[model samples]
Target: MPEHPWDQAGPRFRPPPGVTLYVPVVVAFLVQVPPTIGVGLWLRAEPRWLLLATALAAASALALLAARAFPGLTVAVVAAIVTADLFLPPEVGPPPIALAFAIVGAIVRGALIWALGSVGAAWLVVVVVGGVNGHPWHPLRIAAATLALALCFAIGAGIRRRVERAASHRAQLVERRRANDQAERARIARELHDVLAHSLSQIAVQSGVGLHLFDREPERAREALASIRRLSATGLDEVRGVLAILRGDDADSTTPTGISLTPQAQLAEIPALVAERTGHGLTVTLDDGLRGRMPRSGIQTAAYRIVQEALTNVVRHSEAAHAVVHLSCEDDVLVIAVDDDGVGSAGRPEGGGVRGMRERAALLGGTVDLTVGPLGGTRVLARLPWEEPA
Candidate 1:
């Protein structure tokens, strides 16, 4: 696909190329001498008339240099030169190259109407003066002049349309790239949250337990250390899988896509998660009353993450010992609610976990709300569509 030259600055006046300005000056001056000499010899005109004609032609060519800056001025100057050439003492021909250059500049710089109006006015003057100078009324000449003006207008209009279309295409490509970037960011965020949130929460709680039990119960302290080692290993594996995907590595030996080297947490693993929390002295309960079982992997994964983040918040922020997770289906919505008896409040400050929950819910056309729980602590309520968007 050919890119538009002016996409970076749409619909704006552009300076003419250096070649365009200088080449016209040379060409106009060279062409003007031949006509001036011919008219001088044919009419036995004086040397002053030739000098006047040459000066007007040179000035008109210089006018093209400033066409983009002042297109109307260029057109007006060219029109004045045409008028003077027709009505002067000697019959010097109009500076056709200079006038054409001015007209082209006006069109490219968005002053077509002004340029055409000036040309028409000059042409009218030429016709009237030509008749008074013993020139006959020639229909062919009139028709040819009209056709030339129309052709210039048509070519300018066509180029303008092409530029507009190219600008639109460039805008669409930018928007599409932006949207893809946002989507990719969201996907990576979800993966990191799912992989790290639960593992980190378990490690923090276990570290605290192991320190407290270091002298009193050496066996349980050892168990806590063991749990930390397991969680760390799992977290590392998940991180490696994510890195492989980001690096565009070849498919893993087990999976075709290489996107998930470790098994993802699903709704079925809520019981195991509750058991793990129980080991850390946090009484975690699960109540699953949803009529729909695992509608899709995305919804199930999202549900698990919401519950996991909520429980993690309970473990980290809420000073409560007991937490309850409730999952139910209402109409076409799947609701996941986590409540605790900790010192959490709806007015308390939130972190990335809360934001991640909200973003995940929003992507599914649902919502995540934080409010005061019945147990005098913070509650997380996430609602998502049972059937995912296509």
Candidate 2:
């Protein structure tokens, strides 16, 4: 469960087992407290009345407490209470509160309890007040039953209204949090694309080019080596820019200073990425026939990540030269495949880093596929959904 800052305790607010559900029963019992003591003065003349009333009140309290174990037992006990009041000479009493408790229990439980409980209570009201014409009919008994029913109906409706409102507010908060989280991830993705992609590309380019210094014009190889030096410095600057953004200090000063690339170049931008390779004597060709750009931001992000990971694999595990990245889209599926002419590099076959990349792809509704290409190069392939702006 997502813990709310305000939930100092747990969500349930459950009362001690019996106390919450049988609160009406407890209150009904307490209602007799005063009368138990006061009636002693009146009942001095007839000790039997005092003894009966006190015992019945105690019995009713016990039955209410035991309601969870024996459902509907309290109804009869309440009726017994009314009977005791009616038969004995009436006096100062706490019996009215007991009547209220019966009404509350009836509404909470079911109709049978209500009918039996009210009838038992009404029998006494009629007998004591004296009916229409010295017979068994009485208006006050009917009025009391009607009033109890209305009170329960009102309380039930209020409880339902509060529950519905709370549910609605909880749903709203969940949706808002989801949206905020998505927006944050997108912002971080963009920063990674700009910094990591450009740096890794430069590193892969000049390092490969500089290695040819022994053969094809040693002077030109020196320039390649110098370019590698500059590229490393630029990569460092971009990484710093990315870190600054993460630390909540993004500004013009935080902008990466380097060979800044376009915002929407995916695997299709392999030509530019391989520009240094082509210049330093390596052949590069890219095929991206799929049109309809896959949202500039998403394209840039996936492109950078795929290329950087592929180049790193080549540098670590390969002996041969050259690389090609084929990117396209078939309807909603974005297809990105990076392959290098390196003979031995089987790619990062198994690692948490690869798992993280897979997770990132899945988050965007896609997956990553790695295999050794027929052209003696490692291939890193990925597919992501093409989602449009709302």
Candidate 3:
């Protein structure tokens, strides 16, 4: 159940909303210039560099700062200026042209709503001014202005869709990365389990055999004792590799067994595994031609476990005279099957070890089969995926 370390990494920030929000609103409002006059003709307004220059810069800066919270309000105010142009001669003040983009952008992809608000604000101010100014309004003229506002709204809606789509894509990427990390963590867990479980199981069997020889035949016992020592050393190396994979950074040369460690174990370890198990009074034959062909650590561990677990069951329950383990790569799968002529029910599973054996296979995107062999021996078979990246 150990999880990926990257799962702790959190979400990243999205682009700050409303790209053009600050520019037009603040400068136009502060200097009290129409969008055309305050921004466009600021140099012309300065002419003689009157104290009015100081006043203009200060006013524009404040308006820009305050516009952050009131983008809608600033847009409303500018709309009012446009309406005033209908009754009075167009002033030489700044023209409020670009507020269109700012207001629309703030809507965050709800361009239609932004459009409605912009239109409503503009229409109310202009229509009311026409009434107050004692001027008879022309529908055609108003229609022209309303049409322009509608176009702006449409533009805003398009921008919103783009923003939302990009945001959704980013979110999907985050989720995919999270999922991939979880899968990798599970794979590592299975590899560690297969190594520890298989090796420990082998060591236990070797120790048992050595003890039996010590009591029955001293010479045979000595041979079994040597196998036991090798199993212990190998187990320590695997445990260390597991620790290094788990710790990632701090893991070093020695493992829990007080022996030096290797970076990883390959199929080469299989023969040694089989040889050690055979020394424990069982007959184990490993095919060496298949060694270099099997490359992935995950697959190696899975194949090792199937054989290891199968043998352990035989030693504990079979009371059988002999056992045989076979491991090879077939159709891109690291295939393993262990058979024993033990006296107990060969196919029956009465302990968690069998379940653990199956779990190990499942984690590798593989499968396990346990049943009685035709020879009346219990057979354990596992197939695991092999990594083949160059």
| lDDT, candidate 1, 244-263, per-residue tens | 66656654433333435644
Task: List the lowest-lDDT window of 10 residues for candidate 2.
Answer: 255-264
lDDT of 3 at 52: 45
Task: Estimate every model's Cα lDDT from 0 to 1.
Answer: 0.77, 0.60, 0.60
User: Runs in model 1 with CA error above 4 Å?
Assistant: 1-46, 69-72, 89-95, 110-154, 248-263, 279-281
Candidate 2 ranges beyond 4 A from true positions: 1-32, 35-48, 51-236, 243-253, 256-269, 275-297, 317-322, 328-334, 341-367, 376-378, 384-389
Give lDDT tens digits, candidate 3, residues 1-390: 454355466555555545455555554454344343444355454443323433443343343343456555545544544454434432234433544544564454343454467658668867886778676467886786677776767776777788788689777778977777766666566556556666666667766767877877888778767866776677667766766766664544676666545444446666665665664456766544365676577567556666666776776677666776776677776677777776646345466667667776776688888778644777777777766333
Candidate with best TM-score: 1
Q: TM-scores, in order shown?
A: 0.76, 0.51, 0.55
Clashes of 1: 1
Q: Comparing candidate 2 with candidate 3, which one achieves the higher TM-score?
A: 3
Worst 10 residues of 3 by lDDT: 86-95
